[model samples]
Target: MPLSEYEQRVLEQMERQLSSDDPKLVNTFQGRASSGLRRWVLVGLGAVVGLTVLVVGAATSNPIVGVLGFIVMFVSAVLAFSPPRRSGPTGVVGPDGTVRRPGTAPKPSRNQSFVQRMEARWERRRDERGR
Candidate 1:
């Protein structure tokens, strides 16, 4: 099934409005971060250094030295494999302190209850069948 001209026009209008309202927000979604490769390379290097330290320390025979080496290796492996930590203003809490992911409109979401979504889906299905 394809969208009718009217539906396509409506979608285009909506997109235009959204772009106009928050261009920055739209750009963030469109843009891809390119620095992820650098992060991975750094992590790999750290892991190699950590492994070397662990092996040298283990060979020392002293318990403390061995433990330190193990700790370094563990830390390096963890840093290398763990998912990159994301930091940012994900959402600003109101004075009342409710956590909301950024770009989410609370009021619209609140108004769009489960029942409303079901009803909308039902309507769409009915319309498609009628078409």
Candidate 2:
């Protein structure tokens, strides 16, 4: 069923408020970082691997093999410390609270508090059926 004019206006106002409050929330939401202990442990492991590779490569007789080993070790170290990429909605949320993906219409603002919407729906249905 179509929304009444009042419902539509209320939704629009809620959308406007949410957009003004949090613009960053419109962008991709990044998850929290890993725990400090886990992060440090990974860093230590990377360091150890890097050092071992460097030492073994340097001790080797062949210069070419040593260079290759160094490159591999360097790449591994870089990958280990690299930050993870954000993986949430990259779309901007319009006036609505919904995240608007590219090429899609702005989502309808269903921003009424849950209780409010439910109560309104119940009232509307009751009135429609002459209850």
Candidate 3:
């Protein structure tokens, strides 16, 4: 559905706030380069070829060709679903509670309950929505 002007303005304001608040997030999202129609067409063609090769190899009782066809299918599928590489600092939460993403303020390491964290996030979202 088309958003009304007020809704659009709110969304724009939110976007600006997000961009200013977390440049890493903005960079991650903006740096993504989606595969175009040509890429999809190529992936489709590859899948078709893979299927044909699989069928042919199976019919001819050739295991190598069948394996190759399976590999091709797997590769095409991976390519289709994989997002573009992120350009900003990526963080992984280690088992020892190590969070390391550069270019951002460090969050205090407090062992809050999952429900508490969820509620906090929910409240923040609700406040933003109300704005």
Candidate 4:
């Protein structure tokens, strides 16, 4: 269902407030960069493994193994060079804590229990003291 105009306005206001209140949180809504970097690193590792296998097969004079090694290395190199999928901007947390795109409503803060509220308040107090 589409949001009513009032609902959209309220949501926009909340988003503005949230963003202004916690600038660091905006990026977190999408996610950290480590996950993407890890994937590329894995591809590089596979290439290294394939290269090692090729070297070993050549040294052992195993024609079949050498051919397999060559194929693997070629595939690994291609994968390592492939461009990563472009992820959306970070800090757009979805209902499940995963980041969503900007302009999407975050899951309602209604899920915050008393303890969570208390912790938030306490953190705010601590921050005020630091300031």
Using lDDT, give the best candidate's number. 3
* Position 27, candidate 4: lDDT: 64
lDDT of 2 by residue, 1-131 (tens): 68999999999998778767875663324344455456667766766666666677678766665666567667657766787554665687754366767657543338878888778768867987698
Greater-lDDT candidate between 2 and 3: 3
Q: Write down the worst ten-residue block by lDDT for model 4.
A: 86-95
Worst 10 residues of 3 by lDDT: 100-109
Instruction: Quote the lDDT for 105 in model 3.
Output: 38
Query: Against the unseen true structure, what C-alpha lDDT does each candidate score?
Result: 0.73, 0.67, 0.78, 0.77
Tell me how far the alpha carbon of residue 90 in candidate 4 is from the true structure, in angstroms, after superposition. 17
lDDT-best of 2 and 4: 4
Output the better candidate (2/4) by TM-score: 4
- When sorted by lDDT, best at the front, the candidate numbers are 3, 4, 1, 2
**Model 1, residue 109: what's the lDDT?**
49
Which residue pairs of candidate 4 clash? 27-90, 27-91, 28-91, 29-91, 29-92, 29-93, 30-90, 30-91, 30-92, 92-100
RMSD of each: 8.5, 13.6, 9.2, 12.0
| Residue 98 C-alpha lDDT in model 3 | 80
Structural RMSD, model 3: 9.2
Model 3, residue pairs in steric clash: none
- TM-scores of the candidates in the order shown: 0.47, 0.35, 0.41, 0.43
Q: Candidate 1's residue-wise lDDT over 8-97, tens digit each?
A: 999999999999999988777665365578777776777677677767776776677667767766776787777876656778674456
**lDDT (tens digit, per residue) of candidate 3 on 1-131:** 37799999999999999999999888677764454666788888888888889888899999999999988888888878976455655886644678867544345338988787778767766886696
